[model samples]
Structure formats: structure tokens, C-alpha cells
Target: MPIEPQALRVLMHLVAHRGRLVGKEELLDAVWGNHFVSESAVSSQIKAIRRATGDTGQTQQVVRTVHGEGYRFVAPVQEEPDAGQPPRESSSADEDGLVSPADQDRPVVAVLPFVDLSPAARHAHVARGLTQDVIAALSKHRWLRVLTGAATARLAGHPDVVEHLREKLGVRYAVEGTIRLDGERLRVSASLTDTAAGVCLWGDHFDRTFQDLFDVLDELADMLVATVEPEVGYAERNRSSRLPRTDLGTWDLFHLGSYRFFQFTREGNGEAQRLLNRCREREPDFADAHAWWAYAVVLGMVYWDTEPTTDLLDDAIQATERALRSDDQNAVFHVLHGRVQLARREYQAALATNERAVDLNPTFATAYCGMGDSLCYEGRYSEAIAQFEHAVALGSHDPQLWAFRTYGALAFLFAHRFEEAVDWTTRAASIPNCQYWTTAHRVVALAQSGHVAQARTEVPDLLEQCPGFSVDYADHKLFYLKRTDQRELYLAGLRSAGVPE
Candidate 1:
């Protein structure tokens, strides 16, 4: 009797490790490779193999579950070569577990069907609609490859829904929820999970009156998209961190590089650049890798106290242009390009680029922060502060929270809200991996707000960490500020804080 391909692979893997008691995770790694599947999938495959071999779960003649550990194959079979076919290859049975070439390096997401859970099941339609809307919104992100709602609908009542999705569809993440309507009230609860780890990274419930269906759908879709993006990013970073560097694909490399890029230190920035460049080299057509590589280069110059050389700027611009040429519709690419534009001191153009990014994906927090940076350069400090505020609200748990808070502090400083600036910088400085600049910003805010003695005390530490930092360097490197008064305000604070001229 012929067995399904997956079951055949499972049989081969078990036969290869017969009597060794392969753990679930080991089986997943050896049989499914990079794909993630729960223990249930392993059991399912074993059952199929046993049925083909005239064995039952009760008999335990072919395979045995070790209970809380793994499975063991007790019965062994001898390998024989058929005369009409080439000899069967030995010891390479697990190669089938590796991801296919086309699917390699692409992270997939599945939005499973939402359960109605209403008393009368009348909210089924609403739940389905919400799932579709969420899938559509998540598709706009460009980084995520969202499986269609219809495709995931088959998994509605599976005992292992997330694992089934991961196993069958190669999904790394899953979005699942339920919708209920009772009288005039509507409630939708949603969660994002890392299917591999079987962990929920984020979950929330949206409660609204059942007045306008479309309005409710729109609000929930926006919230899910905004929340999912950052949470998925955080999950990806954590996953990549635990994997061996050799096992990482281009997607995981990009995530790892992003984690490093946000550390806001010179060494971390250098590592980020290296990792992103490796991603670019491995997958030349991966536009996001190119975009992030460019951003990593720019971060070193702007925040990590590195020299912003003309050659570095040119390389960054070229990489950004390449990314846009490949995927012009990516809001993140536009945001990164805008950052490079900001570094070039083309404030208006950067602003327009970031505006286009926001138009592309309004839920993206970094785009708002990019717009805030451009606005601050144009001397619209109040508008800039508002944009930063909006961004912080949208992505409170963002991995780049340090950068956002630091930017908000700069906006407050430019607006001459000295105490608020001090508060913002103090908070920013407290966050792990925040840059040396947070301390600098705090010092400036302190000195400007009449706490001169306290500000002077921080000078030694700042100088020690960021050698050669002086007001002159700020004047020369911080060309994004168009107005002389704003520039002088920054320099004057540094001077008052006893920074070297």
C-alpha cells in the first residue's frame, strides 16, 4: 500500500533512528527541518504509517509514544532495492524535511478562520469578514506573506490548528480570533502566535457597539495590523536569537540585524551592518534586506557617533535606490530611503517620501517617526512632537522604542519644553541598548533648564563613551536642522553643559 509523501518521510526518519527514541523537537528538526509542527502532526504521520503497515496504536508493534519525551520505532524493516528502479539512497531520507527552494527564506503567516461563538452563531459572517479584513491589512505590510482567509478556513476546528497551519502551509506565525455579538454589543478577541514555539505573542479584545459594521471592522483591522507588526517583529528577533547563526536564512538574518541595529551602540551598529550585508549578498533580490542594510549604515553615522563619510552616504543611497527599484510599494523601503534622504539634508524631500510611506501603510509607526524627524528639521517642532507622540502610542512595545523616545526628546528640546525634554531623555536613557546620545540629550535638557551643576557631572561619562564629541561636531554633522536658531539652541545647550567647543 502506498503512503502519503509526508507519512513516507516520517516512516523513513523513524526507521533511520529505530529504537533511539526520537524526541518531538528532534523529529521536527530531522523530519520537518525548518518547518514547525506540533507533536500531534508527528502522531498523525505515525498513525498513517502504522495503518499502511497493518499496525494499530493499541498494538504498539511499529511505533511507540514515550509519553512526555518522544516516539520510538520498535519494529525494524530491511531496505531492499527494486530491480526496475535505481537502488534506494540510504541516510538521506531527512533531506525531504528541508524547506523547498521556492519557500526558503520567506516567512509565511496564516490568518485562521474566526469562530463565531455567539449564542445563535449569527456572528459567523462578521467573524469571517473580520478575518478577511485582517488578512488584507496585513498583506499591505510587504514583509509578511499572508495566506488567504479561504486557504486557512479549512483549519477552523482542527485539534491542533496552529501546528496544522504550520505543518501544512509552512506558516511561521498565525493570527486567530473569535467574534461574538450579544444584543447591541460586539466583542472581537484576536491573538498572534509564533506557531513554532506555540506561544502567543500578543492578544487583545476590541469591544464596540453594534452600530456600524464596517466602522467596527475598520477599527479592529487597524488595531490588529498595528499590533501584529511589532509583535511579530519581536517574536522573529527572539527566534533568530536562539538559533545557531549557521542555521539562519535570509529572513532570520534580517531580523537579527534589525535587533542589533536598534541597540544604538557603535559596536552593535557595526554588527548589524555586517549581518544585513550578509543578507543582501545571500539574497540579492530581497529588497527589504537591502533596505535594512542601508538603514544600518545610516544609523551608525547619525546615532552611533561614527563619521558620516561621503562614500558611506553614497553606498546607502545606492542600496536604497536598489530596494525601491525592486519593491517600490514597500512602505518600509520608502521610510528607509527617507531616512537616507534625511541624512542628505534634503528635509523637504524626506518629508514627502515619509508622507508617501504613511499613505502606503498608515498603521506603520516608523513612518510617523520619520515624518516627525523631517518636521523637526523644518522648524515645525510642535507638529513634530505630535507625530512622535502618535508613533509612540501606536507602537508602545516596539523594539525600536529607544529610538522613538530619543527622537521625541529631541522634538521636545527643539520646542524648548526643557523639563519635558529632560523627562523624555531620562526615560530614553533608562531603556536598555539606548545610545550614548540619550545621555547627551539629558545633559542638554538639564543645562538648558537651570540644572547646570547636575548637567556638568554627566559630561565626563559622555566624553568617555563618545570620544571627540563636541558642539562643533554636532554643528557639522547635524545638517538636518535647516534653521540657524534651532541649531544654535542645540549648540548653546551643549556649551552650557560644558561640552568641548
Candidate 2:
């Protein structure tokens, strides 16, 4: 009786573990890669294996069933050498036992297979799917390089695998986690580790009801991906601070620049530009660096009133274009490109570019924010508000949360929904490190909504923060709005708020 290939593989696996019981789900994942299948499939394969090995369900010999649990190969087994084949050769390893090269310039991360801690070990497929989802999400960013699933699986059960991953796989960071299911509740816990230093950079725990398995997986993956990048950035910034400025690499400079950029202040923006310039000089081919550089220029022009000379605008355009040239698939590059288009008053082009960015990375909150801004400029206020709300839901704790709120407020204001505009802009202003522009929207919304006293009270602070702001500046800012009435409505609100002409 000849056994099927899957059955043969399952038999070999059982023989390797001989005395230990293996769960049916584990066998399914190992042989079928987690494709949905019935338990009957495993039963059929086990029956075939028993027949080929001359074992019976009644005999309790060779393969033995452990009641409701799984199976164990109880009979002794031995490896046989093929007469026609030579001995297998082992792969080369360095002195540290690492197989990959150690001179990687970018941060390399490995997402290890998630451990299943559920009762009866029944959720192995869910754990594996979560691991794969995280890998896929992280791979979309051009900055980080992710290890292959096979490489990560090889190191899964090894003792002291964190150090082994650093040495063998050349990974600077490792993401390890476990999933557990108790009744209908599911819990996921994850930690980001700096392999070189043997320190945990970050950790998080999430709990949700297992109402819809795929939905739960998607929400978990999105939250993890969103948290990981910022945590890595924070870790890298701390690491870079201890190193001499003269010795900083491109990656270090980028992280340091990002730390300053998130401060949302004029001085921070200036320092960010200087550090990113150094990064660009060191590695012109780094697409993420170029995209961020363009973003810095745009922020300076929009918030700081930095004079945007033709050369400066051209440089911003060139930076984003080079980033796209380097990696057209990167959604971040497209977001920056769309921002540049918005600055140029190319509303249609901006809208289309941002849509493509969202299509590339559905979980990218900034892309949706960009899309909202584009729609707002085109006088599509309702549609724009929806996009902004979606962005907020996706990344409520994002570093750019204030920006999303401010934009959402602006969309509502343009739609003549003054109360909502006031609510959102007030929320934006209340957030820590919010830029001064948030107050401008609040003043306009309050004044237009007949709260003249409150609006007037806010004027002194707004003027103190933005002395150069006036009706003319507002007009220039609203130039992107093609509809004359839409632009005039914004100007009238500013004038109502006591803005100087």
C-alpha cells in the first residue's frame, strides 16, 4: 500500500517527534500552509499513514491516538542512508553562528511565528496567520527589511533565539508574540526587541472578542504595524543620541530628524531639515529619506511661512519624484507626491495620487488624510469629511493626529457645518504639541457660528502666535479651492473673526 505525499510527510514528522503528541491543527498548518480544511482531511491522511505502516486503530501500535487530543508515533524508528547518495553538506556559518552578512545599513526585522497558547493548542493557524499578516504589513514600507517566513520559522524554538537571529539572520530587531483564546475572547501580546543590545524596545497587549476571525486578524495586524514603526523610530532616536553626531549613519540621521519633526514647532522643523539634509547627502538613493525631506519642506512652507521660492518648490518636487523613481510601490512616496501636488494647486492630480497611495496601503492613515485635503480643495466637503474620519479611526494615536483633526475641521467648516468645525478644531487645539494653525480654525468656526465673544477672546492668542496672519494670507492659503464662493466664504469667516486685511 503506497502512501500519499502529504501522509508520508505527516508520518515523517510524527516519527521525528516519536513519543510526543502532535495536534491536528499543527499538522494541517505544516502540510497545507493554513488553507481552510475540515478535520476529516486529517483523519483521511492519518488512516492512509496507518495502513502504509501496518498499524490499526485497534492495535494501539505504531501510531496511537490520544483520545480527543492528537496522535503520537509510539514505535521506534531509525534513519536509513541511501546507498546511491553522498552525505549531506552543512551550510557555512560565521564565528558567531550567523549565516547572513552583518553589514546591513538598514534596520532588519524578523517576525517570528506566533506561539499559540490556546486551550488544546487549537489556534495554531490563527497564530501563524497573524505572523504572516504582520510581515506583509511591514514589508510595504521601504525603510525596513523583513526576514522571510522560512528563516524566522527555523529559529522559532531555538534557545536564546534573539541573539541567534541577530547573528545568523542579520536582523537588528525581532518581533515575538503569542496569541491565546479563552472561550470567545482573544488576546494578543507582542514585544519588539533590539537583538544587538538584548533589550525590549516596546511591548503591547490587545484583547478582543473573536466575533469574526478575519476581521480580528486585520485589526490586530493594522494596530501592530502602526505601533511598530513609531516604536522603532523612538528606539533608534535614543540610540542615535548617544552616538557622536560625526559618526551618525543615514538611518540614524533619519530617525533623529523624525524625532525633531514630530515636535511641531518652528525650531524643530528647522533642525529636522538640517538632519534630513545630511541624510540625503550621505545616501541620495534612500527613497524614504527623500520622501521625508520633501515633507519637511512642505511643512515649513505651510506652517512656518518659510518663503517658498521657485527653487525650493522645485527641490520638493524633485525629491518626491526621485523617491517614486527609487520605489514606485511605496505608498508613503505617493502620499508625499500628492502633498506636493496639493501645494502646486493641482487638485485633480493630488486626489488621484492620494487614492493610489490608499490603494497601495489601506491601513496608511496619512494617505486618507491627504485624500481628504484634496477633496476639500475640490469643494467636495462631505466626501472629504468621511475620509478624514476614516483616517482618525485608523490611527487615533498617530503622531499626526492633530493634523487629521484640523483637516477634518476645515472640511466641516467649508460645508457650513460650523458646530462640527468648532468641535473638531477645538479637539485639535487641545492635543499636545498641536500647531498654532489649529486655533485659527477654531476662531473662524466660533465667529461664524455666532459665538462672537468667545471668538474675540481667542483672537489675542491667535495674533500673538501668528502675528503675520491676515485676510490676504488666508486668501493665498485658500487659493487651492477652485470655487470662488468657497474661497470667499473662508475669507468672510476670517474677517468676521477680526483678522486684519
- Please list the residue runs of candidate 2 whose C-alpha ends up more than 4 Å from where it truly belongs after superposition: 1-103, 196-200, 477-480
What's the CA error at residue 130 for candidate 2, in Å? 0.9
lDDT of 2 at 456: 77
Look at candidate 2 and tell me the lDDT of residue 47. Answer: 93
Model 2 scores worst on lDDT over the 10 consecutive residues at 94-103
Tens digits of lDDT, candidate 1, 44-65:
8888988898888789898887
Off by over 4 Å in 1: 1-103, 118-121, 180-186, 206-213, 457-468
Which residue pairs show backbone clashes in model 1?
A: none
For the record, the alpha-carbon RMSD of candidate 2 to the native fold, in angstroms, is: 15.7
In the predicted model 2, the residue pairs found to clash are: 98-167, 98-168
lDDT of each: 0.79, 0.79
The candidate that wins on lDDT is: 1
Superposed Cα deviation of residue 321, candidate 1 (Å): 0.9
